[model samples]
Target: MRYADRLAELDSCMLSDALDNLGLPGAVAGITPIWQGARMAGRAVTMRTVPFDGRRSTRHLGAAALERAVDGEIIVVEQVRPEGAPPAAATWGGLLARAAVHRGVGGVVVDGACRDVDEIRELRLPLSARAVVPFTARGRFVEAAVGEPVTIGGVTVEEGDFVLADGSGVVFIPAERVDEVLAVADRLAAKEAVMAVALEEGAQPSEVLGRTYEEMLHDR
Candidate 1:
């Protein structure tokens, strides 16, 4: 599916609620909001390995591989493991961002560090990462592979999985569960909307919350 279409289907509210329920790491609520230009959309090109290793034979797929993805395919890189000594250098940089833009890649999601923050912001490519650093990752590691299953933010994102993200947050909907999750999200959104209306009408906060909780449980 087109990235925009997936994004539109999931919508910002659904994505936000999913992140809230999933507790993914980088679904940051308040931070330096970089990708405010437009909401990015894409299927996941998941990569779980982290901190580009200085190994030979790493596939520096570079621009060609990046551009090869269908429109709205966001490069999703997952770290090999959640913790340890952080990668010494940035996994991606301005060059990749520029290349991705040309290729119509939706955005980039790194479970590790990324460099070229200023440049990336200037380019206006959506990026979600653990942190930013000045160190570079050239001659260190190559693409090594692509289209493999990778995990990030406690979510096991598979290749070809649908990814929907915006300023609110990112959500990974396993292909098998997309329809189910969307149905649940729609119901939850409706309940939340009613609760919001009650709150605006001066209903007690606790009552509103309690009623909402009861409704969610009943729906289940």
Candidate 2:
């Protein structure tokens, strides 16, 4: 199925709640900031590491490997930085972003940084990362590992885990929990849709959202 179609079927809010249930950290905040443009839906290509040191590098993915990527597979790179030290350099940049989009790669979810913010926003491909920088990985880093487990934001993602990111944030649905998580997310989305319709129909804010949402959503 198309990634956008799959995303269209699920509830973004429910997906957020499911991540909370899973105890994953980065899904809620800065690490997974959603890039505007195309929505991403795909299996993960996981990698594990810490701190994006410029000294560590991988051969830029060659054409053959790039061609291997399809609709729902993300380039999941990780950085394992020490408590006090920060990520070394921007792990992704404009060329990489364009290349990923060209290959029909679903998106990129980095445990570090990205560059060329305006250009990436224009490309409209899905990208989630820690921050943006003009300086990027050139001779510094290469693919440490592919199709291996990687940690991002505080989540351990195994290869082929179902990945989703949107306005709410990014979440990793372990292969084991995909069914249940999708189900709950669908329910939450359905209710939110109804609430949206009612609000448009002139329902008062308090009546549409009610005390539960007003209190619980804010408290969290």
Candidate 3:
């Protein structure tokens, strides 16, 4: 199966453990779905929005990324700020959600903040953002680059990287490491399933989650 197809079957926590087992750094920190039950997995199309430099342009924030990305891909927005500046402006909003929906993109992942939560929720476009605010990016931030490596949620996510974002959190997988990561995650998931079945059979909780569970990562 394709990477995106395979990743869609797994959640962030499983992918996190897989990364840990492989000594990789892809567990995104402080990023979660803005709405409950929202999940997305696809290749990453990265973009960066930095604090404005006292100038303005006709281009809209995140527009370039939307145009550059193909269907079923995720646009990752990395919000950069001036030194000692606060993350106040919103890089994503309702209009973008509507566009994403029409474009058939997987969803959006924002390293900073997003606005228009109500509209986005109504639109039902899955979005994962670090924060939410009413402030607009106008005159505060500008699109700096598209299709580049970006540091999002403290993780260095590159273009074309596999991304899985769900309730637990967002986890990015390097394009080169997807096979190994998927193999490890699949094993861990299988074991966890057995443990769940044992629990349902009235097995002792502690016994089901004992040293064996603790050392499952290194067992491979």
Candidate 4:
């Protein structure tokens, strides 16, 4: 099955555990879905932007990314800022959300702030971001590059990598490791299924789930 299809069947926490079992690092931290029950999986189209220089243009920060994205692709934006400083402005908003919806794009993942939360929610476009603010990017940031690797929440996401986001969090699966990761996740899901049934029968989670963590990692 296609990784995208398989990914749609799993959640972020399941994928995270699979990555951990395989010794891979792709769990993005401090980023949460903008709406409850929002979930998305797609190939990534990366964009890296920097705090706007006094004289540089800030036109079309997200427009370029939308144009470059194909159907079912996610735009991953990484805002460049000074160390230990907050983002100067929101890099995403309702306009971009509408464009993405029109283009059939899966969703957007922003490493910085995003505005127009109400509009984005109404549009029903899945969004995951670190923060939300009303500041505009017009004079605060500029697109530095597109189709380049970006670090979101300490996870390096490259163009074409598989991005899966849900209520738990967001995770990036390396393009080359998708098959292996999915295979492991499938097995883990099976084991967890057994535990789930046991739990419904009044079994203790600590005894059934916790005790099998390491055993399942090494099983099969």
Poorest 10 consecutive residues of model 2 by lDDT?
A: 56-65
lDDT at position 169, candidate 3? 86
Q: lDDT scores for all predictions?
A: 0.64, 0.65, 0.91, 0.89
The local distance difference test score of model 1 is: 0.64
Candidate 4, 1-220: lDDT as tens digits: 7677789999999999899889899998778888777789989999998877776664689888899999989999999888889866999998889999999999999989999999999999999988899998887888999999998877889999999999878999999999999999999999889988999999887888685665777664
Candidate 2 or 4, higher TM-score? 4
lDDT of 1 by residue, 1-220 (tens): 5345745655655665654554432233321224464455657775544334656653543444475576768787754532665656667789888988877787887766778888888888888766677876665445655677766666677877776666665667777666555666667777778989999999998998886575463454
Once fitted onto the true fold, the runs of candidate 3 whose alpha carbons sit more than 4 angstroms away are 82-86
Identify the leading candidate in terms of TM-score. 3
RMSD to the true structure for each prediction, in A, is 3.9, 4.2, 1.3, 1.6
RMSD, model 2, all Cα superposed? 4.2
Please tell me which predicted candidate would have the highest lDDT against the true structure.
3
- Residues 47-113 of candidate 3: C-alpha lDDT, one tens digit per residue: 9998889766778988889998898999999999755455789999988889999999899999889
Q: Write the per-residue lDDT of candidate 2 for residues 1-220, one digit (tens) a residue.
A: 5444565566345677655544543253455554554456677777654433465443553233345566658777775566655666677777877887777787877777777877778877688887777665654445556667777666788877777765566677777777666655665566678898999999999888888655432332
Superposition error at 77 for model 4 (Å): 0.5
The worst-scoring run of ten residues by lDDT in candidate 3 lies at: 80-89
